[model samples]
Target: MNFPRSIRWKLQLWYGGLLLLLLAGFGFTAYQLESARQLRHIDEELQQRLPMLVDSQRPIPGDRDRRQFRLSTRDALLFDQTGNESFYYVVWLKHGEPVTRSTTAPEDVPQPKAGDPPNRLRGDVRESFLFPGPGDCVLVGRSIAPDLAGLRQFAWWLCAVGVTVFAAGLAGGGWLIIKALRPIQTISAAAQSIATGDLSQRIQTQDTESELGQLATVLNTTFARLEASFSRQSRFTADAAHELRTPLAVILLQSQNGLAADHLTEEQREAFLATQRAAQRMRRLIESLLTLARLDSGELSDNRAPCELNRVAEETVRLLQPLAAEHGASLTTELAPAHCVGNADELAQVVTNLVGNALVHNRSGVSVHVKVLIEDQHAVLTVRDTGQGIAPADISHLFERFYRVEKARTTAGGHTGLGLAITQAIVTAHGGMIVAESRVGEGTVMTVRLPLALRGADST
Candidate 1:
């Protein structure tokens, strides 16, 4: 049989088994008592009758030689030895005769064989009798078979009472088990509902030291951490956007002034170029900050359409090739044909930032490799760089907005420190994840993961 899942069901099974064991024990006890009682009663009856037959052997003074058979209306008889009858009244002897006879016994009453005397009634009911003296004359006997219908009826009633008590106990145990587990059921429901976006939900705790109470405390702590993180991210986004406005406004005004000048000389042209470059940097910074803000805010794109991820990787490589070449780096790609559900533009940006970060940080001889493949039901995009790898501590903070591994490199290469952050943000918006792997001497590898098919499901 299949087992039960709930605590109450388990309790029922255990209680029922115990009840069965108890019932069996009681039945064994009852059978033993009944057998012993029957044996003792038959033994007492035989002892009482043996002496009465001997005393009544002689003739009564008034009634003459007829023996007084005190058989109590039970069949009684008397016999002499040598298989010869002395007197027969209400009882008779047949082929295998009783040593003694009972007057009330049937004529065909089954008798013990010559050497095989009947024992006390400890087995199935059968007719029998015996005596200890010579010939049939010394043996006298009677039959006594009391009706046991009343005893049988009482026994059935006792069994019924036992069964009723057992059933009640089983039911009571089931109720107790349910009561004990109600708190766990409550906790499970609360957890499920809260995951459906009820941040206000808090577990009910009755005892602080109990296991359930401890679990509730832990959940409350986790919620507090999530709330604090969200608040910090929101503030950072506002401050970052405010900081980018000034540089962007200055660049626009300078560009307008240069365009309005009467005669543009080579020196003026060079100054204008620098101003434009600064303007472009400010614009990129604002875009990166916005992207990070969207990511932290959980404003994800729902546009999940089939796209060749490898094609997107190749295009990003082509676009960033000139930038890598300027930094004396070689950009290479091994684009595998892989399909996924995500925003194509977002995937492109993820590849672009990894390549850009590699080229900008390396002093000389940088090599970038981009590959697209499927791994464990996920679309894997890896971008590896042959350069001075990022430090172990700095790799984790690489995706944080405006975090730089080396400040000197940031200044020399004009890095705003928002490239990796923007890349991570874009990947997240498409319901994917990104991580950087690096050691002290070995080069860094940044990996991006996207679901093979969106299927209207969250990221793995």
Candidate 2:
């Protein structure tokens, strides 16, 4: 059977099961004790009335007076209060023969047999008692129905109370478990925030000796180390990219100059052109790395002035139209006035990167569509392309640095593979998010959402 996997529910099940077992055990024990006590009380009542029954008989002097003696004895015993109809039964036996029985005595009650025990067999609901008398034996019995009924009622009451108590305990225990685990819930929230790039978030620990507290302490230490390591790596990459930029620019310039020289041989000219392309690729790669580093270090200042996203989308489409045409692809734009607070150049770069990716990856005859619109107080930019869609396994890592779907495809275009990564970082810096949706053989859609700027003419 599939059971609840939550700790709180498991605890409640265990607690309720143990409680039910305890209640059942205690209830059974109490019922048995009460039943035995009631039966004993019945036996005692029968014994106490035995003497009165025997004393009512007188010794007979002759056989002729025996009938008279029998009649008087029967009359005396029959009129006794102990022999009431609903309470007790009385029988007098002589020489193994029943002489007189009370009016209330049942006919099924057997005659006292010779050498029978004082309290012999009657039945479950009735108890029998035999007392030796002067030349005779007396038998007394009482119905134990009232006692059995009382025990039954008590058992029912116990069950009701036990069930009520169990329900209360289960509810109260669930509440207590939630309260007790509140710290863990807080820790989980902090961890999620950290995972989402807020490395400054830490769990607030109050009891270092406890398990959750200790776990929080360990996680905080690990996060601190991770943040520091990332900071160092980002700084190194930014410094290296900055240092190589000037040298790469010089190398490209020198190679172009050599190719332009009138004295250069054909083979030498080709070699210089290759060097120029390599240096240009290197420069682009370095610039992309620098941009990522800046985004990671939070060095880019936020531009709170309203920028028209529709205008940026229109301009990017116009600039990339030639490339789309060269690939035999149709480029179209549906630009609506949507304004967001971000750098105009950076937002333009985002549009350029998305449209550029669509034009580059798609085959001839594919159509690329760009749209800018206002959606739920956000500037929504959507770029959709009717091209070969991304593989399921490669979609998730598309924004990772230097990640590409296939090395051959990237090599053919001389792609550095940092375009989407840089694009994502820029969007994130603008307090926006980007989502990519694609299915194999269906095409791809990239959606960017930026918070709308609500101030000044931007609100229009």
Candidate 3:
């Protein structure tokens, strides 16, 4: 059988298995000891009776026949007066043939063979011999049926007690394991909560000397350090983005003034145009970085309001239509009334980023299709592009910050590569999810799902 996955179950199994082995060992030892004790008791009884039986029988008066013997009056009185239910027999033998036997002796009772020891036969029925005179032997046989039955009853009781003990051990061991591992389970639950963006949660330690308590202490320290590190990084990005904004704006304005001046030569105009484009690209990169920093620092609120997703999709398509036309791509939309609870501005940004990526990352004459509908009480927005599809390996990391498909293919557009990452963060803040699917030659499809506003749904 395959082992269990939980530590509690594994501990219970091992403990139960060990207890079973112990019980089995103890039962076997008890059974052997009881059987031996009964046999030893029978042997003692047979030994005591042999001499008396031999003494009781004597040779008949002047009889030369070896088979002739008689019991004394005292021995006959003693044997007949005993009321014990255990059947016993005595026999006198000479030269391996019976000379006399007691009245109650069974004719078929086993006799000792030649060369056998005095106390040879031992079992439920035991036999012992006595040599009192020359060429004369006496054999005593006793039925140990009472003792045998007592031993058998003891064996059954031992088995019953062993089974009861084993069952109790399993239950008690399982409870103890659960109690011992409760701290570890708490730690695991805290770790899961922290992983789901609640870094404020910490493991509470009850006993520092215990292993789980020590682990909790270490994990609490690690989480504190991680939260501080993330805070510092977020602050640094926000500061840098804020610092670069003014300079980029000045650069753009100066380049625009130079381009509009009447005295500028052709070479000068081209240079100024290039400078303006570079400044604009830098500004867009800084803005994306600032948005991500705010998201990380929890400064941007997910303002919950009724948002019509179909309206957002239609606007985003219209806004990106010029870019698609410039690349010889067609923009089409299939919109249904889909309403969700989110910030309209952020949802618009999400649609803009998706549609913009589709249009910019496509070959000429490719079609970009946008769809908005309600599925399973969630607003579903899908953007599909008939462009060069993503590589299989790159699809998983597409939403990761600054990850690009192929360096050469991505270099043509001045993409900062933070679009999908920001889009995912915004969707997650709104309690939604986004997924991307692509094949080598087919195309790419990005699906976004947001929970529908309860009030809007009720009204509908």
Candidate 4:
């Protein structure tokens, strides 16, 4: 039927069908009851009239006169002992023969047909009764037509009122259903607006304790997160372009200068080697940028298995121990067993960056400390170094790509300045966190925390 899409129409259809069924049931019950009552009333009326007829037409036992009995009756019929037609239906019989006669009845008065009641007939609005006589009983009947018309009228009015009430109830119920669903409709529209790139759009809350209100609150929180992510991506793109251009320009200039030179001295060759080192640093910086891009795009790893944090720390310290010796510093580890879900190579990269950052920055016999411990349902790995700690002002931006506090460190080792930034991205991709703690002259401590795997998970 192409029914309405609105909740109002749906509710009406549901309750309206029920109302119709209830009304039909009531009508059926009423019809049966009224029909039974009418039939009973007709039967009682016939019973009352039958007795009066019996008294009015009573005849003497031996009279045998059909006219005498027939004229005395007003609206009745009589039969003799042997079955026959009669009037007012009164009949008389001769002594020992089959005989029948009527003296005072209408010609059209029905006579007993073969296999029919001898003196009674039933009709739509009347019932007839028969009484036995030695020609001494009669049949009496009364019309019940008047009550039928009244009952039909009452039924028509009842049906009309029932239908009207049902329609009213359907309308009232539909209104209530639409009112209840209105908030859902509003929330849907608001969601559509948000999907169309309107990040600032928010659903209005009416009832804080209701489910819809909670849904609106959740949507608002999700929008806030999406906005922050968008802002970070935009900033990353701008910052990466600016940082990469400087090193590329320097490398290009160094190549051009070397190609134009002739009869170069040993010092000139050494300078050229330094230029190559700068180009290598630029290459590394570009690679780190690619890694961060992959991490942010969620394309990093397909397999994550439980890894021993203690083993990762030992390996990271071993790789950087040479650099520490070069700098007249010691690399050390205070490893403890802890398990996490991660890509091993990526976790190794995070540990290497932290300890490398410490060794490069500290020249005063620095000691690198690595530790594994359980904290707040997570496996924690820490790298602390005895180095010239970061100023409070520079701590916040230390992990930003190409953000350096000292230009002298950048020149000496051609530091790409993306080390800690790469570390942060790796840790984040593994569903972990990295944070730095430093004081101006004491040292720097970097902590990475990862979710710990349960017992069975570690079996893999």
Candidate 5:
């Protein structure tokens, strides 16, 4: 059987089962002890009155009927004629023949059987003690109807109390299980937030002595260190990119001047041009790095405004048309009013990079389609290309910094491998998401969904 993987249910089952067993054992033991004690008490009473019953067997003095009696108009305590006691006895002769018996004695009690016990129950009678003497043997006993009824009621009471206690125990156990797992739930929630790029989340430390409390303390320390490490890395990248800008600009200027020299041979001109191209590529890489660092720091969060996604897609297509022509790729569009709130320039970059990627990385005659539409409350942008598709393993890492499906740092088109990563960061900043779908030899589709701007909402 496949049970749910829930610790709460498992603990409840074990705890409840154990408690039920304990209550059943206790109630059973108590009931058996009480029943035996009642029977023993009744037997003791019967034994104490057996000799009196023997003495009361003689006929009363001056009685005309000649029937045995202990006294004339005796107290009902002897045979229960005046009260509710049901005591009775039967006397027998030495030869096992019946002699006399009390008025309340049962007529069905036959002669002493071979296996008759000294103290026994006959029919409804609880206890009948045999008192054997020189001339007579008496059987003293009483009916146990009232005792049986009381015991039956007691059994029901025990059942009722046991059921109540068991139910209460199960409820209490379930509550305790939930309480015990509360810290784990808190930890999971905090960890999920951290996973979603919020490294500032920390588990609350309410009980340091517990095991889970200690674990929480360790996780908090680890998260703090992680936050600090990421902060340093971001600062370093931004600083390094900023510091390289002037040097790269100087190198580019020097190479451009050298290439424009009047006395330069053909080979020298090519060399200078190559140097200039290299410097330009380095500058673009540095710019991408700076952009990533800014995105990491959420610098463009305040630059958001309401914009039409259709306008952005149409303009981006127009801007990239020449490049698409150069690569022999077809560009298509189905524009709709897809209003969203984000930095228009960043969202445009997102479109430009996706379309440019399709154009640069695919074979000639591949078609690239740009779409802008709305689905519910989201502005949807899809850039689909009939180009060589990405591998499944590489698709997951497409947004990772400096990762490329081609696995090379430099491409003929000078891709710095940060374009898609930047696009993802920009989309995330806009409170949006992007997805890539592809199969080998079947082309790729890049889909972006941004929160739609509400009607009449103004740009910030």
Candidate 6:
């Protein structure tokens, strides 16, 4: 069985069900009690009139027949019945025939014995029996059809009243539940905004002492600290990378000059060459750092013109051809016009990092295929490599900064472990997403999806 996903609905069902159960029980109990009370009232009335039937007996003064004389005393008690609520009686002798009976008494009433029970009910009739003499007995009764009808009506009314009360209570309870969860909705929206790279977002707490209010306050404080820490880190990275550029350039320049000197011995020339290579590697590392730091600070391209995604892929392919040849890897492409809005340089950098990562991390003879096309109103680019696939456990961490899988392959070039990180940062800045899919012994596929440019964008 599937339960409701919303807490509000779950709580509503539980409380509403409980309320219905309670109302059902209460209504049933009330109906039973009222029915019993009405029956008791009928019984009491029959009991009281039973004595009247016995007392309304006498013998005629000069009449020879005692039964005929006994009938003469009941002039006030017997009457022509006009309604179902009329009282009547039937007196029987020991031989089982009625000795004396009222005019209003039912003809079908059995002749009750002297030792019969005091009260009984058959259908709508209530009766009480009594022994007036050694051989005479009396039964007094009334039609209780009116009382039964009233009780039926009362039962219907109870059902209606119960349903109305339950409906009103459920409505009130739903309103209360919505009011209680409004704070959680606000918290969710604020957290979503903050997650989408806006660290400045904070939850608004109206009451600091309440439970939810206290939670919001704590979250807001945490966001403030996070924003402060990221700001300090970005500033430091940008400042340090910028500061190192001048000295790194000097080192490169001096090493080149030393290599050009004719007076230097062979060993000295090799030393200078080694210094130049190290300086060049350091310069490259610093450049990568500066690029990452800028992307982290949300400093993207100044010139975000409309460009075809296929054009960027073609250009990146041309630039990386020499590296592909050096690794004995085959580079191929299937390009389609996929127009988007972004800096061509930044987009090219993304493609370059992905292709280079695939080429550098795999052994010789690995085939790399680049694809660009439009899919579902978005520009889709894929880089698939026919090499040993990534481990299942490592795919989740592929986009994290400096994360590299420990695969057995020959590295054809230097990897700073920040390539995929930079690519992810740039794609996110362009409102895009990237995903990696792979399995053991199967090849890996890197897919990037970016929103399509407007129809009027300059694809040319």
TM-score of each: 0.50, 0.82, 0.81, 0.46, 0.75, 0.81
For residue 73, give model 1's deviation from the true position in Å: 39
Per-residue lDDT tens digits for candidate 3, residues 214-277, read: 8889999999999898889988999999999998989999998888899888999999999998
Per-candidate total of colliding backbone pairs: 22, 0, 0, 6, 0, 0
RMSD of model 3 against the true structure: 4.2
What TM-score does candidate 2 reach? 0.82
The deviation in Å at residue 283 for candidate 1 is: 2.7
Order of the predicted models by lDDT, top scorer first: 6, 5, 3, 2, 4, 1
lDDT of each: 0.66, 0.79, 0.80, 0.69, 0.83, 0.85
lDDT, candidate 1, 1-460, per-residue tens: 2456766677788878998789868866785577567545645554455554554444446864233434433324332222211223222223223434543434553434457554433222322335434333233233323324434654676688678878897778778877777777767777775554344456677876888778778877886676577668766876788787886888778887886788899898888878887787777677666766665565545665788888888888888888887888888889877778877777777777787777877766778888899898888999898777778778668777677777324456566887887777677666678888886666889899987875544431
Give lDDT for model 2: 0.79
Which regions in candidate 1 have their CA more than 4 angstroms from the true location? 1-247, 263-279, 407-410, 454-460
For model 2, residues 1-460, the per-residue Cα lDDT tens digits are 2358876678778878987898889888988888788777777776776766666666566763242124355545534544223444555545555667666666777666557667754554454555555346667776655666678899999889888988888788789878888888889899888876767788898898998889989999998998999999999999999999888888988998898789888899889989988898898889888888988887764554677999888887899999998889999989899888888888888998899888887777889999999999999999999888988888889889898888213345677889999899889878889999997777899999999887575531
Whole-structure CA lDDT of model 3: 0.80
**Considering summed lDDT, which 10 consecutive residues are worst modelled in model 6?**
64-73
Report the Cα lDDT for residue 151, model 4: 78
Model 6 agreement with the true structure over 386-460: per-residue lDDT tens digits? 988888888999888767786644433556678898898898889898999987776789999999999987774
Error of 6 at 107 (Å): 8.3
Worst 10 residues of 5 by lDDT: 64-73
